[model samples]
Target chain A: MSKDKLTIGTLLFPDYDLLDVNGTLRMLGALENVNILMISQSGDKIKSNCQVGNYIDYNFDNCPELDVLFVPGGIGTRKEVNNPILLEFIKSQIPKVKYVLVVCTGGGLVAKTGLLDGKRATSNKIAWEWVTSQGSNVCWIKKARWVVDGKFYTSAGVSAGMDMALGFISDVYGREVADNIALRTEYDWHDNPDWDPFSDKILEKK
Target chain B: MSKDKLTIGTLLFPDYDLLDVNGTLRMLGALENVNILMISQSGDKIKSNCQVGNYIDYNFDNCPELDVLFVPGGIGTRKEVNNPILLEFIKSQIPKVKYVLVVCTGGGLVAKTGLLDGKRATSNKIAWEWVTSQGSNVCWIKKARWVVDGKFYTSAGVSAGMDMALGFISDVYGREVADNIALRTEYDWHDNPDWDPFSDKILEKK
Candidate 1:
């Protein structure tokens, strides 16, 4: 809860979506004093769905205390949801971090943790059925850009994470700080959490 | 220019902006048949400005034929503009690629090459003076989300590259394809190149 420096631990895995993590990091990185740690199960280079690889800074064991825990969605989450090691890592960090951000299908992974039970969350609309199936007890909102329940923030899809990240900045910093970051990055941030346009288009197709 | 499979080469360097590349890639990754190659000067892990590192797929010497050459912006551009190795690599790829996408201060690096001498372009508004100074002969537009001069595409700040990427997708694919990607990602695509809001805000401040 200290404001001096906030360390954010980002969970990464093989075939993870690139934008889910990096796009959100773009908004968070603009903050003055914040540290980013890329963490994987084995601390090796994690390859994205695009076949691009990123170096990991820490493993689950050596990860330092984090103010924020970021989990990004990708094809890897399908297999990782059943991974007790990764699931245990997410569960153990939830109680310790000040905030948890689940983007895209990452909502499914956290939903599997049984942490969002009786809580509201949202995930990628295209993968709605799979994500919602993971947590029957969790309240899944289909028409939401993002959902914030207590300390957890879950977004709709890949780029929606950027908007949710700005919302997080608005909460942690101030509205002005978030707006300034949007201006700096030239991002037209959908400041309103409920201002989602794609949910109906995608969900209705199903 | 092959319709079957397009190859994209992304240039990376130390202290490169994370979003400048990934945000754009988020839109491009949605394409059905495309290959992404991360290239750097040394074919080593290049550190981003946020201190995160990405593994490079190819070095300048080993780089292959590219359909699109992507250059990302960051604080490193100040120094990279003078890096002859990178400049030569960019210059070498320019004639071969169908399109060259430059994001944020990356315009400065490309401007140093003198290839955009008489072409219209734009860059991160906050770094306008520096970027414009890099190419005195280039016609730099002060207010634009992105500028397209023949085969080259230059965009404003970090997140603007996403809009440009969508624009690129629309140009190569159909407009419906670009809109579908936007809908899928839940991104508010600023379709018009002239719809820049930050240029006057940041540029006027200076």
Candidate 2:
């Protein structure tokens, strides 16, 4: 095993979409020595929007410095947008981490962090208007499957996080590692970042 | 309410890849009144090969007849292929369920049920040879993201299951419902059933 150890923290909250968390985890965790810390505010068993539960590895107070911060979203992101404690916890870590990857409406949370104020980002298209409105200054890409502005990677929605994770892995490790993951997972990844066709359908209707 | 209640039993064995279960659940659970049962051999919390834990909703002995049977896979699939109890449990349910969906190496387990004996199917490309060999009479598609043979839908691997779920939802609910899911999840779904580029790359190497 390579002596490269990168600590990855996947933040969890109430009723987050398990697809984003699990699919992204499947990709990132495939990397060697990539420690995944399931961080939550209370360190409780995080209940997913899909009715599944996940045991939190650390509470906000005990969360260590991470190499990468991963945030997933669901119905909770709508309510958690105004949560000062979660916002503060996230804000404190933004400057210290190597990067940040936001999934679905997790972009809403990241938007609250002010990290995307001047950065290009994206979020779950179904809740596009509400999430994009959170940060007025951020340039929200209306037609992106995922966005990578500097070290920040933001995915469109739940399953899109899987694509973002594959891209993220490719960025961190290289094409071979990421391709190996897609091959192992038997996923034909639409690696093109500008692959979101939902924006036209969902946003146009709304 | 549409009075549409479909019980989706997601089979969880020891060391199953959590992605297959999580991705498919995100899509199916989005529907109204769709119950997801995380079934296992013993109804114990399954420990995934990736070191994650998922609690089971039902054990094999107590599992009810289902509308849909969902199966995921991992290293455990290789061992479970010979498991008579597990095979019998699957064998018994073949006639009772409305349809069956097998993801990744879970196809290996399904092949042991002899239900796919004359059906076209696929599995994780990395272990395609071994999994396909389980059902000698079965027509194993060399390049398919997923295959539909009667009441059975078998996906090539991990993330391909998500694509299959989208297609399955489209087939059951209607184009609009599945479209809504893809839009809401912001997933740029591989809707084409024949999109399996990795099989050429991965299988060719072997």
Candidate 3:
């Protein structure tokens, strides 16, 4: 990790959501002084929830120090939440990283670590109940595109990660930089953190 | 390639945009019984514009027959547009596929092949001039989130690819299926094809 540039380590597990990682990185990667690293358990090609295979850059043992830690959720989180190695790795990175961003069910994996116990967070509306159950003490906001509490940023399912990533940029870099990136990408960014429309619709189905 | 399934072969080159491919696939991949194969000049890890490396599933010569051909644009298109191997590959796939989906400067790559010579299309608004220059006879639309000309579907820019893809789904599958996929992904889908706002802003800057 360079002293001048921010290092972002994104965790990749089996069955990880493609958009949750790539969509968010699409915005964050535009930053001029950021080192993005894809980290998996074994540094192998991790299969996404969409069945796409992505080769990772680093693994648990050899990952360099990171300024930001990103975790993307998928069906994999259901099984990975119980994996001791992953839980321990999340716990290890919590205290060192300046920011922690969790997308979709990834909030469940991090919440299970007990670090966000008292912090306000959110997750995929589709998996709200399951994820909310993971952290009994965590303040889970149901109606949010994303929630930013202290050093933690958690977004709603899949595509909402992009918005959360932009919000993260707005806080760290400034509003102009984030807005410029959105314009460059031609992304219709929901600047408001509370602009969530799926909570009621998705929750009603259950 | 299974006869019963729709095989989608996405072309990858060095400096290809990550979200252009992944974001589009994030929507399309949700379709049941669709085969998604990543293709490149060589079956190797191709570096993205963001400096991310993605491993491809097939090389041009060995690629199986595809129902849909996808092309994503990045800085690589500037150099690749002149590359015969790539130009020939794009030209060859034009007549065989059921649909041709081009994202960003990918419109430039396909247009350079002369297949889109008389077709109505569009590309990244920021790179409007450069992309429009690729196909001299092509009818390029200046204002559109995406344009569907016959079998061809072209999107404006990076994140717009997701909207174009969902539009592609809505057209092919029923509207309900596409809407369900958008709901599942929790994506705020701009369902209208003419919902482009960046064309004026980006082109004016030039």
Candidate 4:
């Protein structure tokens, strides 16, 4: 990769989970040459589902070309997944981007864009069935911490977004860099690649 | 309390943890009748610590008379705790407010104002000493999830703010109302009355 820099863009929408977006951004911000952008469908600031005065910045049209695109899940994803403009944009951008990351039901949005067709994916437990319903060709991985089929990476709910982002960093730079980022952020990165939230262990513990 | 309505104000600083503030707001928003305002030092949009674009709405001078003032912790709190203007504003407003809720090291700011003198308090593990060093005659309960010394309520890290907010709601309203809010938000309320984050159980688990 050129020292010119790489941009990571995360889609933000009304009622989106602010932490998922932030956790990812914080991790990526630690990368020396990465530029992170918070983009929304209308490019206008949208209220986060967090309701505590959190918003996402930038609009889709104004966002710079991205090397990575991340979509995080929240109540907003229900409407966002079906937003034609957003879906079309993702479809147009996916092939050009080096990686596409989706967390929680964000996978649903990517699924709706037909990008995950014939690929393995995962999402929040509440939205797993809905994710499956979106595409018959996509193999919905029932027990996966994150599914990486080709350039697409997907993780389970909220906190899982942090894991996937770190994983992406690990892939691009190396595991050592990702570990340092996780340590600095005080997050415990689960090294088990096959960990899944829907497992009987997690459900039973909950 | 008459249904005169209580206005709750939360401060936003650059690099503030969006989740800590938003989680508390989400709980408060579910309440029957309350006004919530997001205030910043300058009233300009304050980016969160994550730099993902979450911001609170109002500025300090424009803040309305508040029934309660909530301060949430993040990397931003490190600077805000000692900000002269912010400390002055908080000192001026503390006498008028009915209650003050400080989450994580947000208590450091309150402590700076001498409000927590001869009181007990707790904050996130990372800042417990910093909180104590600020001249509060504080009984630092290491294992406590939250410490409520009279009208002052202080909690541990990020998610613990949600718990302390619910506790505040219970005090202002009733246990039933708090319980209902917790259920609605899918948060489990432990009725321990005190929260200590540094206990062996929490540390041992990690």
- Indicate which candidate wins on DockQ: 1
lDDT of 3 by residue, A104-136 (tens): 999999999999999999999989989999999
Candidate 2 DockQ, CA atoms:
0.62
lDDT of 3: 0.91
Candidate 4: the clashing residue pairs are A43-A59, B15-B49, B143-B196, B144-B195, B144-B196, B145-B195, B145-B196, B146-B195
- Tens digits of per-residue lDDT for model 1 on A147-199? 89999999999999999999998998889999988888888899889987788
Q: TM-scores across all candidates?
A: 0.96, 0.91, 0.97, 0.79
Specify the CAPRI tier of model 1.
medium
lDDT of 1 by residue, B92-150 (tens): 88999989999999999999999999999999998899999999999999999999999
Cα lDDT of model 2 by residue, A144-200, tens digit:
989999989999888888899999988878889898888788776879989877888
Best by TM-score: 3
Candidate 4 C-alpha error for residue B7, in Å? 4.4
Instruction: State each model's CA lDDT, in order.
Output: 0.90, 0.85, 0.91, 0.73
- For model 2 chain B, give the 10-residue run with minimal summed lDDT: B46-55
lDDT of 4 by residue, A16-122 (tens): 76556665666777778877777877766567664553454567777778998888887787887778998888888899998898887788888887778889887
Which should have the higher TM-score, number 1 or number 3? 3
Best by lDDT: 3
Pick the winner on TM-score between candidates 3 and 4: 3
Q: Which stretches of candidate 4 lie over 4 Å from their true place?
A: A1-6, A30-33, A52-57, A166-206, B1-7, B22-35, B95-99, B143-145, B158-206
